[model samples]
Target: MSVFTAVTEDDLARWLGDYAVGRLVSFEGIAAGVQNSNFFVTTTLGRYVLTLFETVARADLPYYLHLTAHLAHHGLPVPAPVADRNNEYLGTLSGRPAALVRRLSGRWLTDPTPAHCTRVGAMLAGLHLAGQSYGRRQPHPRGAQWRAEVAERVLPHVGAEDAELLRTELAWQAQQDFDALPQGVIHADLFRDNVLWDGELIGGVIDFYFAGTDTLLFDLAVTVNDWCTMADGSLDAARSAALLEAYGDERAYTEHERRLWPAALRAAALRFWLSRIEDLHLPRSGEMVQVKDPNEYRRILVARIDGEARLPDRP
Candidate 1:
């Protein structure tokens, strides 16, 4: 389950009717994601993941479907979408596009250690290397583009006392001179919940809704912040090292990328802060959802930039 929502057996049966793979016997809501409603469906034949689109643009799905197929073809650990009887991978359900994916058999670790971080880091590197050859794809604009929403939607919702701090930081960041890092197809969001584990090993990755064309190092920086940023808003050096080393082993960082790490980390944190704040103010009904605290990421970013936190070594 990816989101905190409900899915009934009848809903699954109706959705699975178009598919020839199996007859749906049971279904359950998946509670791990915050974007769309998800269900773990079991059939006479096998298990599959059924997602009911919430706020996602149907136009944006081709990138996810094609990207997952491309990575799977390259032997990376990604879920493959199953086709219906008409050979279509996407189908309409309750006025939304839905798809059934082969269920990856694994458990999501509630508490991930450094070892899990290392494996996930390696998996991310392999996923990126395999996707380097994929056809060009673009990110869909957030319901509001990052800039306008950050200043308008997000700022108005934050408490007045904390608003000035974010405002100051945002203003400073906007004026900073920085170089554009390397560009590629990037999995911009790689949270631990998106990774599936079997015992102590990483089984596979899921959720490609945030995949897009962006600075490659920027994507790595996002992963670092999500997987290695600590509860106290500091970098977990040991975990960060494991992930960065794993990523560097696949595609060694250029001197430019190395130099941009600090800035990129801050930028990534700001991006999530804006997105989470936006979501908090505009909650969607019937969508499996949660409100993330943007302040946590902001604290981590400030600490890193202020030299109070240690950064991972450059390779």
Candidate 2:
């Protein structure tokens, strides 16, 4: 959520006239994320987040917008798209695909407690269940195929050790069979920054652009890798257990999922590591671009590879 396309007050005021969100009162560009141009917009009716697609193709926009709406309609706390007077969710603004979603209250939790992890775990499981009936079928955007393609682009910039790790992991992940695992629509990027919390309770989950159809275990792995880690990239056992426990209460993990947990954690780490490397070396131009450190996930990948951090067996 950075400023790639600038929207002036006058420009936005004109655009808002086409919608029933009331007149635009004030608007400011958000600078917390690396993808897309986001603005915190306030109108006579309520506060909202206006997003202009920067890199995502216009044709792929409907899957994300409607998926969010579906989850929200099922009582999941997510940002549902606001339809215009014509009852359309997609629109052209500033020559880019744009959308407006009701802004969820609360700030992101930077330093979370085990209680916070538990809440997010349960909410994520509920989200997965709610999305089972969604008719869309998009593959995980950052899955093994994407990682393999991106690895070729980033290998030139990394050291020999990092390059070897990338190649080895890509090949290993390719050989693994995930077809036996339960699959569904997943919030593939459910990092702490993407979830909002009012104190210990989850306010809402935001940023569904990365959501897609994937194994439920893979989604849990992506979440635990971020929410249950220490600064040194070591897994926090108590928090990880809490998260897994809460999630299991909603939908119990199958034996296959439990057996693949270790590998799934490594795959999640590799996905983010590869993406951060791409962003650092092959960045897109934006007024407020944020290039995160690839080494952070690199360390995490190494930790998952070297350490024995496994979820406890179901009781």
103-178, model 2: which lDDT tens digit per residue?
9988897887888888988999999999899998898888778888999999999999999999998888787777
TM-scores of the candidates in the order shown? 0.90, 0.98
Candidate 1 lDDT over 161-215, as tens digits, reads: 6588667767766654443666777777788778888888777788888788777
Q: Please report how far candidate 2 places residue 202 from its true position, in Å.
A: 0.9
Which candidate comes out best when scored by lDDT? Answer: 2
What's the true lDDT of residue 223 in model 1? Answer: 84
Clashing pairs in 2: none
Looking at candidate 1, the ten consecutive residues that score lowest on lDDT are: 140-149
Runs in model 2 with CA error above 4 Å? none
